[model samples]
Target: MKRIESSKAGGSQFIPGYVQATDYSDLESFMVAKLKVTGQLDMQIDSDFQNVDGAVSNAVVPELWTGIRDDVRGVYIGEFAFWYSDYISFIAESPNGQFTSDEEREIIEILSSFRTEN
Candidate 1:
């Protein structure tokens, strides 16, 4: 897998070695099945470019937003962040229909553990 790295002016950085999947539809489907949510569910994952001050000049950062069927579920437990030019989204579904506050915290912890530096 190719290594990806990004750094910001304030020393904020992200360097992950894991291979990013081009398509996450299958993963979403699996999670929906595991969670046993009724009806069809759609996963929304996208990124937008934003200008940010870097070490030398203004740099573009990809802001990522990821979530699953927020309309069907009342509380949306998803991730949104701005990381060096790469957008990363770790999707998780709660088996109890909707993610509780505790479950959201746990998911955030799990995703944060994968952070790495080059």
Candidate 2:
């Protein structure tokens, strides 16, 4: 239910509203989410996902990512963790505001297509 209406505020280029959330149960499982809104009603950037890990044994390293793309913008969520450091990345775009959708999509694709160098 955590969703952001736009991609503005917080010095971000997108429109200006967004929702984000994080959840933790015990010390090994956690999740983060984000969403963008349009005109205060529609969900132009419809997107979400979760990342899980085995913190107790520290023997598992897992990550997952998913995305939806369009000319307007792209929405993406990634979850991954290493030991005590948990990482999540959420992104929305407005390369130039006048046309934030296209830019947003491009950003989403790039983030979705990342690979670890190690």
Query: Candidate 1, residues 25-63: lDDT per residue as tens digits?
Result: 222211111122223322443232222221111122222
lDDT against the true structure, per candidate, is 0.29, 0.28
Model 1 stretches with alpha carbons more than 4 Å out: 1-62, 66-89
Clashes of each: 0, 10
What TM-score number comes out for model 2?
0.26
TM-score of 1: 0.28
What lDDT tens digits, residue by residue, belong to model 2 across residues 17-87? 12233323123322121223222213555454222221110011222211211222223333222222344
